[model samples]
Target: MTTDAADKPRAMEEEAPPGMRRVPGGAFQMGSDAHYPEERPAHRVVVDGFWMDATTVTNDQFAAFVAATGYATVAERPLDPAQYPGAQPELLVPGALVFHMTDGPVDTRDISRWWRWTPGAQWRHPHGPGSDLTGLGDHPVVHVAFEDAEAYARWAGKELPTEAEWEFAARGGLDGAEFVWGEELAPGGVHLANTWQGPFPWRNFEADGFTGTAPVASYPANGYGLHDMAGNVWQWTTDWFAARHAADPAKPCCAPQNPRGPAMEESFDPRQPQVRIPRRVVKGGSFLCAPSYCRRYRPAARHAQMVDTGMSHIGFRCIRRDPQNVQGKQKP
Candidate 1:
């Protein structure tokens, strides 16, 4: 059978509609002074009103896009010949990798102990070759790169939210709030977001009633009526990743308006020149988030990932604006 025909999944056409919400633009504290050093010097940023997804894009939503566009994700596509000039022929297989958590601590020196280089892990098959999105129709789509996200946004007539816009919405109308809900991660001893609740890599207390990804609206919405903005999956933003602090004295005191990230670096990764490092910011934290490991759950906290590397905990949301409704000045 032809490669194109062989690659099609039987359930390709099934997907749910995308969920969206409108965010009012105003001034909000963009970074946190207490969290990661990169988020230090919290600054006030103003953003124009825009429409955003109430929740991250779910498996079903992405399945529909695949059905309509016949678009293969980076994980599904084979490595480009020109990119990897001298890569081992064996490593050129077309597939995405999966990281399965074992019951005990394994040696960190060898990544194969946890991350399996599965050849079939894609949006439809999240756990590698045999798995399918049969029951996870509502779960956020995993293993999606920035390119895949951009393709979906283009098809849907929307765009990825900028870091400022994402941070503002994540605040849920509460300026300078520590989290999406407020100061406490779980107010009144309640698990608000889908996050690691128990011992790392071993016992998952399931305090949040979820050991993995939860449904889109599994938790309460923030002040802006956005759900799953603090945890579950890290949503991709349009800004480039810069290590500089938002309030760094080296830069101006006045915050940037509708800020975009830094320019792409011309120099390539000497180790892997095949990969171009374009700057993009990822907001919110993921299920793997923990104080012991990654504490990106904070509003101002951010992380930088290559535009091409997609992981199980990384997903995205879409945005749009009417362009006619201007708003009041952003507050400081």
Candidate 2:
């Protein structure tokens, strides 16, 4: 936990990233007790105002960054067998996780039934080898690993938001609201965010008018005038993933100020001790979330993602926490 002078409110004068909105930060409830166990003991947190992109980074934006740097995303590079000692050699290829719709209802408990590691499934080739970003330039760039997003942020002179900052901005000043818009998931039978409308893994009602990623801002903005804060894609946060949130400060006066998550060693996946990759906290569910299975299209919802893996449903946005949005000057 870190704290600056909470009384001394500093106005960070800076040029925000293009298409970003400045979030005037204050105290808010950071987690949820209603949903998953990991989001328990909703705690109090305070953050300083920062500029956040109105939406996730679009494919066009990522393309521009790659063009300028000739950077290859993690999915495009061959996997090192050394990382997974006993893994099958056939599975050790350049690829990414892509969600394949099942023909009928299947056991949702095993996610491997639908999520397949398809070769050549990078950001550009979202679906597979033949797929390309021919018409989806404005859609959120998916299949981006943690390092890929960091590289893009560095190239753009920005930084990824902390879990606290991202949640604060997502809440949009509605201190304890269930959804980004309000308590109801969809008011007046309208689709508020890009989430699954039907059963999980097998069927998609497409009631939201999108089976996959929708273009940025296709949905309405939150109270802070930031779009897609609830869904469309899960955005990366800088904090390491914790099994559960820390209890709120015992004293009201000492509530965590600009708090971050646990250390890297603490974030390693317990289920796979042999694999040393750490997981970070990813906020705001994705298009794959559903009512029956994963109803995580809310401000308080969060998921842990392994730092080394890139999936088709994951994307990211950048933030500016310093007065000047210069390199190495911004805070997480």
Candidate 3:
């Protein structure tokens, strides 16, 4: 694998896709050993230059896709009994997992204490039946399943970034850095991203001035002029989730280039063989991440999300691999 992008022409020199920025690709350390075990064995990876969305897909943007296609998100479709063999019939309605802050401190280990499987909780109604995208046009769209995001990307003539691409962009040219901006979570007492300020599951100080998802680009742009690369919402990636990263080669020159993650079978949940839904890798932590609990607000942080599931904190962005298709934008 070549670590040099010296010969590869920069995407910016050519026309870039609309609403996206060119990310110059080169060799970078892909994972982290300082944080979660899943991010251990940091290894070098090389990816081709591509155009990535400056921010996550916004509510208005997804609405345009839905309006054009009249497509129904997975959360809006009724759960199939065949897919969930033992699920209760009454519980098999159209809905999604919503986050409800606990009244007081609860068991952080049990995520159910904070998450509720509420019916009628789709992308439009983020909280439940009563909630809507009232003033969230600029906020990142959530409650979108893997299929939903892929559909939008296809409709827009783009595709979801692979895990390696996402991590590379998230790093913002700062290879092996602790956080996106710098080593400190809040450098000079300023919150660079929208992460939880207080205890998890119960209290929130809103020190970042956002209790939930903030508008895209509310924070400073990264080295590549990309926004919300860290904490805002977990962005979907194309790679299937693996428990841990593959071991690096004995030689630095042998690093993998454009490496994909584990296959579908390897990404299946071992505990739930009955429901064989393969999980995808979701990059960047959400606003709910806190230091005391999930301190995964860094670029290397990743979480596994079931492809069939869509939660309030999961959303996505798109990327364009072919520079020749720069003129192709969202269809009218």
Candidate 4:
């Protein structure tokens, strides 16, 4: 299990939060030089020991939260015209980004070819109005905006993980290995994570036994016994989106301790200066990721997702940095 000293199970007297795994605090190289530019300049990072959810928040779990608190997800709430100037009133209604397979191979650059902003595409109606939780109770909840995730985390007495903490835990003690499992993406032709098998945006080979989202823990857990850290669905992090992790290792005397992302103002997409929406770093790619297209199913890989928006492939998990967040106190 490659258990680290800090992560090793303590005495039974220690109160471990249920449905979470303890990730030991330590320093390790972060980001990747071979992958996307955002993950470039692979630098060092150190994080404190924290308890992270074993799997992404599932539909059933989120339903319980909603049932108890009467919470309404972002996708269920109407958009403010003030926030989105020049937008049609009809378009401003409640909706979310939903994925639909194209008829055949088309221009992969245009994401709109496969994604539709369908009305009533909230967590309860994942596939739009006609869709319901039905058999997907075990699958990770989707169409949850950052605030929605934050609300759930607050309700559960937890917080979303920082990008570095998530990446560190996702590494599962393997450090800079290419894949979560190891160097080989799939050893012996085994599908380690639930990712797109065929070409994305058009077809899915379903080699991993799932065309869409798979149930949590459908694949083998990483070394830390954390599941769905690589694929199944992208997970939200607390860090704001930054173009690059340009921290020069040569300049820093030591690895940054629990490094955070750029400021909220700096998180806006430079391309869309007209829009003021901020972006957050979402780790772990989703089932839609394919080698033909987005190869982001690595521990170091990250994507900039708008804070006010959620897609069919986006979900999240929570972490407790201190015992006080859950239990009364930490045991000596």
Give the Cα-based TM-score of candidate 3 against the true structure: 0.93
Residue-level lDDT tens digits of model 2 in 62-112: 999999999999999988888888888877999999999999999987889
lDDT by residue (tens digit), candidate 4, 1-332: 22336444541346878999878777788998887888888987777778899999999999999999999988998788898888877889999999999999999878889999899898989989988989999999999999999999989998888898899999988988998999987799999999998877788888889989999999999988899899899999988888889575666657677788888878865546666678999999999999999999999999989988979999999988865223212111
Worst 10 residues of 3 by lDDT: 323-332
Off by over 4 Å in 3: 1-10, 269-276, 323-332
* Candidate 2 segments whose C-alpha is farther than 4 A from its true place: 1-16, 269-276, 324-332
lDDT of 1 at 92: 75
Candidate 2 global CA lDDT score: 0.86
lDDT string, candidate 1, 223-267, tens digits: 767899988998898777777544533555555667655556632
Worst 10 residues of 2 by lDDT: 323-332
Model 1: ten consecutive residues of lowest lDDT: 1-10
**TM-score for all predictions?**
0.84, 0.93, 0.93, 0.93
Model 4 backbone overlap count: 0
The residue pairs found clashing in candidate 4 are: none
Clashes of each: 2, 0, 0, 0
Ranking by lDDT: 3, 2, 4, 1
Error of 2 at 143 (Å): 0.5
- Residue 194 error, candidate 3, Å: 0.6
